[model samples]
Target: MVDSTLPLFDEMPPAGQVAAFKAAFDAWLAEQRGSGSLRQDGSVAVYEDMWEAFAAWCLSQSPVVTLSSLDLADLQAFQSARFGRKSSDLSLTPRYALRLMRLIDRVLRHHASRTEAVANPAAADWIAANPEIRYADAAHADPLPEYLSVSEARQLIAFLSSARPRPGKSRDAQAPLTWQEVRNRASVGLQLGAGLTPGDVRALTLDSPVSQGSRVRERPWKLQVPGNGNSPARETPVAPWAAELLQHWLVVRTEAGIAGTFLFPSTRTGKQWQKPSQYECAKRVLEEAGADSREGGSFRLRHTFALRQLRRGTSPQQVAGWLGIEPSKMKRYERVLPGVIEVV
Candidate 1:
């Protein structure tokens, strides 16, 4: 059993380089833990086990794969040996493969940071340049995301369109719809029409719905979805029918005198709505529409929007742009395209 606490030598022979690398990585992990950067949790054990397994594999190689000679090819060979079809007992699922890849990349990056001589083989740019390094075993990939059928979507839209707030009494039944009801309709409409995530919907300002000086009630309303570190800002056109619902809400919003910049704010405080409140709103709306509220959250609404575009002869790349996701992520949506038989 190799002791991880073993101190690395300034110079080591090819045979002992792997052990030295492991020692350095272990020491780094310990330092991180001591600094409160890494938690003392099951995840630390996972990292240890994965690194030990990888180091052992390196020692077992015919030429003894060492730190100095380690490169993309070496990593690829190790991945194939451990996870490819030949290893029936240790065949890798996509999830495990992804985790393994992440572990290896982190370890390699740490090693590179300490030892300037050794280049990190798993550097993001290098791996991106060599796309084959990514686990692309489509056969074992997770199933396509769930989305609403056309009929279900239509039903949901109809329910939202005619939905009115319940009256307090028989005489008050003729009262107009509340602003909250209109806001809920607009929120759901943005998700179902523009493929906006709940975060995207929450991040919107009063001016988000307007596009190129277009008015609130205008046709072809383009929604400006704000972005964070992961995705860039994008503008997507809301479906005309959904835009109509949104228009009604915008009018109600102004008249209601809600004192917030956020397009959807708390009805009472006019502050940003909490995540649970948004989720509950979506759930209640789904339940009211007789849709599967259990599995059909805001994400399902976005997925439905994606699927709808794909089914309507829109290119996957175009749809991906609309959804503010990478084009590669759209591959899953392609599985459900018309005439495409989805293999279980």
Candidate 2:
């Protein structure tokens, strides 16, 4: 018993559909405001502005965009248009991008909950499918610091120590103990053994690794980490194991004709290596030593260094000085210490 004059919602005109969506959106916002779900602040204005931009973009698309028609691809395209397509060209950082995506997801989920006909395309499963979005979500999440266990550290050190130097003209770049391998070994060793940050590693000069005359080979090496705007200059002792690797690198670096003041320099120019290259070098070493390389980068190694020192009865203040960070920041590490429970 279909009425001949009944209105077809599915075949509604693009303009009408957009108007309907706007009306539904306004109603949702009002309900959220009334329920105190949305605070009376600048955040509400930001949400409104983002929605306006999204709606305008939807209207501009061919065949028109309806609330029900929105999908992951459409959301991704909107993100690409608002932010830049490439990571380098991105106007917003990962955290901000994550906030934007979350806003859209929330609004859509609210709309879907009220309308049985509509489905939320930005569900957790769908969002997890996009690596960029997933990474952004993770970047915004609160998590424990990534570090190595005592056993893992021992295994990594053993591997680095056993890796023999292959010094010859016909040596493969991929082989162990080549110029690059020795350099990477020393770089990672600084992070694990001396608690050097990636920036600290880059800032080191040829004379940075100071050793006492005559006892240079017998005693532990001292490193001079230069200060920047954030931290002050500090001298820290390097572990004997790591110092040995660094000494080996000095010889290889000279023989390989890497002429520069910088300790870890680009092979061709002997100038400071780019940040990405430095990170990759550390990551490669971690992978070779069978350590986790997915998160934390060199910072994990630094964390491992901090935890190791703390476990050995080193005071937080002293460790903080070595790390070039405030002592209060060490509280996080203290809370994670084995057999220690934070009251607060």
Candidate 3:
């Protein structure tokens, strides 16, 4: 629904107030596309989609829907209606609801400014009705992010690079095959170095020439990592250390008589790795590397990757786009950024 290409008011009669405002909203979003504030990641589309969904919902509820006509009751209805929407599975998370409301807030504010209206009474009413509409602080939340220090990450990566089941632990079900250790190292490197999830790593195809032919002894560079779900793929710069480790494993992966579509395949057979098997491998790797005790499963690496970015002064907006994290989820990492908190 929202037509980004159409004019807000051109060729419209003066009586078309609601259509004018809706057009203005879409036009504003179109302009936002060029701004650094708007993410190039698919999230921009998702944001648009939320607004469109709200618009469609409003149309269903009332024939003449306008920003000024909307009140606190209407907004509440929209929030409650998510329970009935098939996309959200009837369980609209608080965080999702907040972003939708925020975008509603943003659009009304912009609409007022564009129209030179005295004030946005509807926006005011919604704000007053829900004072706690924003995301919570991650710094003080339960289950704080588990991150490894730079040195600790290095230690873990080192262990993973050489990790294989000891002869004594051969009976253990969690032990990775010796050759599979190499694959695990490469897979973990993406998470530790570039913030990719296991799914993101599993989604990678090794048949490409860059992956199949890149040399560690030669020029090292970045690669585009595909994202899962609505998240867009991002180009991740490969650090020499991570590149060396990944490339080493690639060679070993090839030599092990494993040839499959995936970058990391099952050790039992060179085929796609199922989700459960992926988790088992991750648990085994973390246990061996002393990172098994982290509260969040596998997600900690993603958190660590995000934390590292914030620590190094990367903008939260850019980092969010790079990591495919939603607006609410980024708050957890925002409070930990430098200058926001004290370090003892």
Candidate 4:
């Protein structure tokens, strides 16, 4: 029998039934809290707060209510009252409404699983109907990369290799090369030219191979190296421009006498640099070089490398092996990169 005294619902039950239900519900909630199923602290506080707000809104409808006693119609009415109606200042979109409804349903199902009575099927049906509510298409908004054109790539290399164009005044010689400035430029080449991830760049140690050659090899930190999903180990090649920057950085590093195992050490800590440090350095370099920060970061450089390979008519299987992604994933990049996708 249902309890009428429960403010949320009109049905009333005997005192014994109400006492037994309350005891079981409290015991079940305690179990969930102990099992780490119902989050009360940490990052889950925000979610807890949101659920409590929904509960408060439901309770505002009537004072004599309990969660277990609430039916689908009452819950739906609460949802409609809070989210369906629009105010002058702001209105809840279908997406936001779905988000809250999902959370509410999740808690309700969890609670129902602990009890004898089954949860309402109508709420479940409503959830099934509102699946895949996307607020925006972020994928289409991503812009094309502003990479170094083939001609520009060659020009930049020549500029770096060449001496003064006209032998200007002493002003040129007096310019100070801040350690950070040099590292930033090297970051671009290492990522764009070498196809190294930001983590790979950070984990670089002084002992890393920097010999004068196009085929310089270095094993980045284990974390930075890509796992073959479930396969054996493999080696990825270094790009020519990546090799050039690496070669130049080696000369500067040797002169500085920086003795840490880490190729990039934090000036403050004298410790090997981490991923965030390397990312910031790379961002500065890309911004300075007028490259789009969104498109020319380490991942974009890797994308460019894969795209170039695909454009050259390399098979998807071969490109997949090089990029350490599944073959099907490689096809997406090929299709996305302009000029690489050729429909037969």
Candidate maximizing TM-score? 2
Off by over 4 Å in 1: 1-142, 163-175, 211-220, 339-344
Error of 2 at 82 (Å): 13
Q: Which is the winner by TM-score between candidate 2 and candidate 3? A: 2
lDDT for residue 264 in candidate 1, whole number 0-100: 92
Residue 66 error, candidate 1, Å: 54
Residue 28 displacement (Å), model 4: 37
Q: Candidate 3, which segments miss by more than 4 Å at Cα?
A: 1-144, 163-177, 207-220, 267-269, 326-329, 338-344
Cα lDDT of model 1 by residue, 1-344, tens digit: 99988768533336466668677668779877989988968878877887787787777776777765665567657766785455455436545666666666776767777777555554342233222334354354544666776677888888887643333544246556677867887798788888888778778888787745656435438887788444678988788777777776776778788887888996645799755567657666777888754333457788888877776778888889888999998887777665433211
RMSD of 4: 19.0
Residue by residue across 1-344, what tens digits does model 2's lDDT show? 99978667544347686786687668778888999998877878877776777788777776676677776566656766876456674435765666666666676777777776555654342343333455665643434566776677887887775543434534344354678887888888888889988778888888788877526663448798888555678988788788877877787788888887898996646778755567657767888889855456557778888888887788999999989989987887876787432210
- Deviation in angstroms for 117 in model 3? 70
- Can you tell me which runs of candidate 4 are displaced by over 4 Å? 1-174, 210-234, 268-270, 295-297, 313-315, 338-344
Tens-digit lDDT track for model 4 on 101-192?
Answer: 65666666656676656764434434432223222223543334334555545544443323212235442464556555556666556555
TM-score of each: 0.54, 0.58, 0.50, 0.46
Pick the winner on lDDT between candidates 2 and 4: 2
Relative to the true structure, candidate 2 reaches a TM of 0.58
- Model 3 lDDT per residue over 1-344, tens place: 99899778534233565466568568668667767668676977787778777876766553445667776557766776777768745237655666677677778777778778754555444433332343232334433455665666777777865543333554255555577766776677767766777677777766321443355444234556666664677666555566666666766677777866677887546688755566556766777887764245566677787877676777778788767766676776665554333210
**Residue 111 in model 2: lDDT:** 79
> Please, what is the whole-model Cα lDDT of each candidate in the order they appear?
0.69, 0.72, 0.64, 0.52
Clashes of 2: 0
Return the lDDT, model 3, position 104.
76
- Where's the lowest-lDDT run of ten residues in candidate 4? 129-138
